[model samples]
Each structure stands twice: as structure tokens, then as C-alpha cells.
Target chain A: MSQVIVVTSGKGGVGKTTTTANLGVGLSKLGKKVVLIDTDIGLRNLDVVLGLENRIVYDLVDVVTGVCTPKQAAIKDKRFDGLFLIPAAQTKDKDSVTIEQMQDLCEKLKEDYDFIIIDCPAGIEQGFKNAIAGADKALIVTTPEVSAVRDADRIIGLLEANEIEEHYLIINRIRPDMVRRGDMMNVDDIIDILNIDLIGIVPDDQDIIISTNKGEPAVVNPKSLAGQGYRNITERLNGNNVPLMDLEGNTFLGKLKKLFTKKQ
Target chain B: MLDLSRIFGRKNNSKDAAKDRLKLVLVHDRANVSPEFLQKIKDEIMQVLAKYMDVSDGGLDINLTTATGEDGKSRVPAITANIPIKSIKQK
Candidate 1:
């Protein structure tokens, strides 16, 4: 069955595009046909993140307006087969694409692809509404901060009000050292506040910035801690019982435990 | 040797403070009530009550509170107004 999932965070700069791009690549790495739609419209960047910025012959607005087909607008990724991206229109504003048009596009995409991931724009505005229009589930990405958590709470209320039942949380940029020092909100604190099921927890790693800058999905980068988190999320999405990655950096005790276990 | 700051410091850390503030603010935000709105309601309520009784303005405490319902699971928003009445006006 095809699934349309909207990745959104009410606050900007909380890694919605990063999560969407990585998940798209991650899902396709599992051999699932996935198409990622950038619904940010004027503030489009998913194409850039995927390193396919130069190959945009058609965009989401073109597909919605019947200027081009969704298939024609979808850019196949060279790094992975079955992974495609529908770039948002840079010239047009968010108001150009209505919620119904987005829903229709998602409905059409659902027929061919195994997964249709919508990268929602930040804020509870028209763009956000359009992104979640046809999504069966939602993945809210947030950082471990009070402001981000608060915005995520508001978004959760909005999502519930919209009757989107299947939604999960993705806590991004978790700093274990800061969390251990009681200087940041831990995963448990966020879960207690948001009261939602956590799908993934991406650790704050420098590798993420490098990968994003290179326009490569971090999930494909084997050495990335955030990439491993995304892989676990993809597994969970596919109904596999994958364990969450420990954001805690390896302590002496943890290292000793691993060493003893490996010896056995 | 142990890190002294890790052991003795961080009693009133900013992280806990931030979490507390967010918890309080989100209660009002989720209930769709702002601080100004609550203050307005309190002022209007005090004004209405003062007309009927000798209500003191100093000891009045009107705020939005959260309490669990009969299910005892969900935290529900409740308004608690504590107005001090000096005497009842006889008309």
C-alpha cells in the first residue's frame, strides 16, 4: 500500500527539509519507489538538498496546473534508483497552489509510488495546510529546545484538529553531552511534553552539515550518526521493529560493556 | 578526580527553568487563552463582583489552572479565581 507522509515542523530551521530528503533517499534505498514533493513554493530548497537543483525542467506548480505531468516533473536521483523529487516553484508564492490541488497531486502520486513524502513549509499557514492535505501520516521534526518543542506542541494540536491520526515525532539535533549535563531537554522530557510516539532521534553531528552542504542525503553517508537515525526511522516506517539509536556518546562504562559483550 | 561543577553546580539551571516556563505558557496557548485575555477576564469579573460586594483588589488571584478530569489522565484547563470579600453590601 502507498503511504503519503507529510514532514513538518511549525518552527523554521528545525530540519524539515533535511528529514524529508534523507527519508526519501532512505526509503528508496530499501528499494521502495518514493517521490518527495517540495511544497514550500517560493522558499523551495529540497531540490538543492538532493543535489538536483540544475535539472528542474518542471516543478510542482507545473504539474498541478497541468503544464506538465507529475511524472515529468519528478527528477530521478542519480545516487539511488526509485527516488524522485518534485521541486517547488521558486517564482510563485505559496498562495498559487491551493490545498485541493496538493491533495489531487498526492492522490495521483499514490497510484504509482510506494511512498509520497511532502516537505511542509514552516508555520501553520497555507503552505503547511497544502502539504498535509493528502498525507495519511505526519512526521514532526523538532530540536531539543523549549521554543521548538512549544511550536511542535502547537503543530500537534493543529494536526490532531485536522484529523490526521497517524503521526510521529522525530527529535533532531540532540546533544548528548549537553543533555547529560542537564543543560538541554532530554528525549524523555520532550516525549512527556509532546506526548507523541517518537520515530527517531538524530544526534547533533558535524557530519550532517557537511553532507547537507554537499547536497547528499546523510542516510547514504555510512559514517553519519544522524544517517543511522534516519535509517532506523525508515525501518520503523516499514513496520520493522528497529531499536532507537542511543544518543548518549560512548562513555567508559558503555565502552567496557561493549568490549565484554563482544568478547563473549 | 570528579568534576566539581557537574556534582555541585546546576541547582537552578536554565534548562529546568525553560521547561517550566514552556509548560506554563503552553497550557494557556493550548487552551487558546493569552495572558492579556486572562487579565481582562479577571478585571471584568472583579468589576462585576465589586458592584454586589465589598471586594478587595489586593488579595485577588485570578489565573488559569490545569487539573485532571474524572478520567484522571488528561490535564484539563480550569479557571481559578480567588477574590477577597471584605463584607456583603446590603441594599
Candidate 2:
């Protein structure tokens, strides 16, 4: 069965596009046909992040306006097979597409793709509503910051009000060192507030920047800690029981020292 | 041993402060009610209760909380009011 999931963050610059791009590539790498829909309208970055900016012949506005079909607007990934992107138009504003049109587009794409991941724009505006119109589930992405978490909480309430119950959480850009020093919120602290099922926790890594710049998603790069987290998320989405990575686990010597200190 | 540092310490770290602030803000945000309005509601409730009974000035509290219902699914927002009454009026 096909699943239409909307990846959203009410606060901007919380890695919504990066999460969408990486998740699309990660699922496609696992042999699933995935199509990513960028609904950010004017400020389009999913195409740039996926490194498919040069091949965009048509955009979502073209499809919504009936100027072209979804298949024609979708650009196939250069690296991962079965991965495609329907980029948003840079010229048009968010009001260009309505919720009904987005739902219709997703309904048509659901037949061809195994997963339709819609990258929603920031804020609870018409753009956000349009992106989530046809989604069966939602993945709320939030950074470990007060502003992001606050917006995430509001997004969760809005999703619930809209009757989107099959929603989950993904706490992105977690700084374990800062968390250890009580300088940043930990995973448990976020879960305690959001009170949603966690699909993944991506650690803060510089590798994401390099990969995004190269137009390659970090999920395909085995060396990236963030990539591993995304891969684990893909596995969980596929119904596999993969334990979350120990992003903040102490070293063996550190654990032994703690044990000795306790004994003393 | 009474640790002097514990008695006069920098009370909260930034992370804990963030969590505390989020907790308070989300309760109000989720309930679609402001803290000041909650306090107003608490005051009204106490006044209504005091009409038939002697209500205490303190210990009257109202809060928006999240608790799981009987369905075992997820947390639902709840309004809890606790008022301390001294005595009931004799009719």
C-alpha cells in the first residue's frame, strides 16, 4: 500500500527540506519507489538540496494550474533510482495552489509511487495546509531549541485538530555534547513535551552540509552519523525493528570510571 | 553534609530552563487558553464556591494538564481545579 507522508516544521530553518530529501533518497535506496513533493512554492529549496535544480523543466505550479501533468513535472534522481522530485515554482506564491489541488495531485501519484513524501513549508499557513491535504501520516521535524519545539507543539495540536492521527516526531540536529553539558534539550526532554512516537533522532553533523552542497543526500553516505539515523528511520518505516543509535552513549572507559566511582 | 554550593547555586541551566518554559507555554497553547485567563477562571470558581462555603484564600489552583484517558491511546488535555474550602454554610 502507498503511504503519503507530510514532513513539516512550523518554524523555518529546522531542516525540513533536508529531512525530506534524505528520507526520499533513503527510502528509494531501499528499493522503494518514492516521489518527493516540494510545496514551499516561492522559496523552493528541495530541488537545490537534491541537486536536481538544473533538470526542472516543470514545477508543481505547472501541475496545479493544469499546464502539465505530475509525471512531467517530476524529475528523476541522478544518484538513487526510483526517487523523483516534483519541485515547487520559484516565481509563484503559495496561494497559487489550493488544498484540493494538492490532494488531487497526491491521489494521482499514489498509484505510481510507493511513498509520496510532501515537504511542507514553514508556518501553519495555506502552504502547510496544501501539503498535508492528502497525507495519511505526518512527520514533524524539530530542532533541539525552544522556538522549534514550541512551534512543533503548535503543529502537533493543529494536526490533531485536522484529524491527522497517524503522526510521529523526528528531533533533528541534536547536539549530544551540548545536551551532556545541559546546554541543549535531550531526546527524552523533547519526547516528554511532544508526547509523540519518535521515528528517528538525527545528531548534528557537518557532513549534511557537504552532502547537501554536492547535491547528494547524506543517507547514501555511510560515513555520516545523520545518514545512519536516516537509514534507521527508513528501516523503521519498512516495519523493521532497528534500535535507535546511541548518539550519546559513554565510551567503555568512561563507563568503567563511573562504575569505579560508584564503588568508591 | 550541607553543601553551601547547593544552598546558593546558579539555580537552573539553560537547557532545563528551556524545558520548563516549553512545558508552561505548551500547556497554555494546547488548551487554547492563556495563563491569565486560567487564573481568572480559578478566581471565579473560588468565588462561586465561597457563596455556599467558606473558601480558603490560598490553595485554589487551576491548571491545564495532559493525561491519558481510558482509551490508552494518547494524552488528552484536561482542566483540573483544586480549591480548599474551610466550611460549608449551615442552612
How high is each candidate's TM-score?
0.90, 0.83
Give the per-residue lDDT of model 1 (tens digit) for A154-234: 999999999998899999999877876678988888897788999999999888889888999899989989999999999
- Worst ten-residue run, lDDT, model 2 chain A? A255-264
Segments in model 2 whose C-alpha atoms lie over 4 Å from true places: A250-264, B1-11, B35-91
Error of 2 at A100 (Å): 1.2
lDDT of 1 by residue, B26-77 (tens): 8888899977898899899988998899999899998887778779877678
Clashes of 1: 0
Candidate 2 lands at a TM-score of 0.83
Clashing pairs in 2: none
Task: Give lDDT per model, in order.
Answer: 0.89, 0.88
Which candidate number has the best DockQ? 2
Model 2, range B1-91, lDDT digits (tens) per residue? 3443234333587988999788777867877887688778888888788789998877776778766768986667788877777999988
TM-score of 1: 0.90
Pairs that collide in candidate 1 are none
Q: Quote the B-chain TM-score, candidate 2.
A: 0.63
Which regions in candidate 1 have their CA more than 4 angstroms from the true location?
A: A253-264, B1-10, B35-37, B51-53, B68-73, B85-91
- Error at A138, model 1, angstroms: 0.4
